[model samples]
Target: MAKAYRSVIEASMAQNDSTIDSTIDSTVDSTIDSTIDSTVDSTIDSRHDSTIDYAIDTTIDSTIDPIIDSTIDSTVNSTIDSTVDSTIDPTVDSRVDSIIDSTIDSTIESTTERRYS
Candidate 1:
């Protein structure tokens, strides 16, 4: 049981580390994309400052920024919720159940031994 618990812990840690790395890479990529989009918009605006260009810039900002923000927010929230549900909660519940089962079995065996002896 102890061995099993230790294995679960190690596996959970490895999974969490992998998740963190992936999340970081995803965030960095998203940030870079947003930055590049903004830079391009700025360059276009500088070259041709017109009402239509202004509207396009406004549309891009309104559309792109929120989409990026929403995507990031959803990603972070889902990651957190999944980590708690899939990893932390299950690990804790497993350990607790194991300990309880061990204790109960030990107690029952000892009681039966005393009666038989």
Candidate 2:
């Protein structure tokens, strides 16, 4: 009877050891699966961030290009206006300047003739 009881107990112990080993294997598999999932999630997140950054950069460039062009145009226009007098007509100025020069020359000629006489 004692020998039979000992054999039964030994058999139960072997069965328990097998169950523990199976549980340990399952736990290891679960850990590996979790690690793989986390890696996938990290890759996806990085890709998403890169896409978002690219989109933002494109948006900023789109917004800045027009602003820069407009600023450049305004600056060029302002510089031109400041450098040259746009209000005065060139034709009128040339006529007045020519008349003044002719009057001065005539006055000088008449004064010289009178002094010599």
Candidate 3:
């Protein structure tokens, strides 16, 4: 009777150990699955955020760059053309007209003198 009781107790302990081991394995598997799911979700969220940021930056740059370039071009062209017209065009015209008038007068005088002589 003592030996039978000892055997039964030993069998019960072995069954308990197996049950504990199975519970531990299930818990570990569940923890690993939850960790993987969280990691995947975080990675997807990060990628989506990064993509959105990049798109916004690209759109802003594209929209603003042309306006800036056009503004710079208009300013530089207006400044240079205005400066040249104001400073150089009138002086050149005045000098050219003076020379032409002088030459015409001289030619007319020579022609009149030859005709009179």
lDDT of 2 by residue, 82-114 (tens): 656654556668889999999999999999999
User: Taking the tens digit of each residue's C-alpha lDDT, what string does model 1 give over 40-66?
Assistant: 778877777787888898998999989
lDDT of 2: 0.90
Tell me which residue pairs clash in candidate 2: none
Error of 3 at 79 (Å): 0.7
Q: What TM-score does model 1 achieve against the real structure?
A: 0.35
Each prediction's TM-score versus the true structure? 0.35, 0.47, 0.56
Candidate 3 segments exceeding 4 Å error? 1-50
RMSD in Å for all candidates: 42.1, 6.3, 5.3
Candidate 1 Cα deviation (angstroms), residue 7: 99
Q: Order the numbered candidates by TM-score, best leading.
A: 3, 2, 1
Model 2 off-target regions past 4 Å? 1-26, 86-117
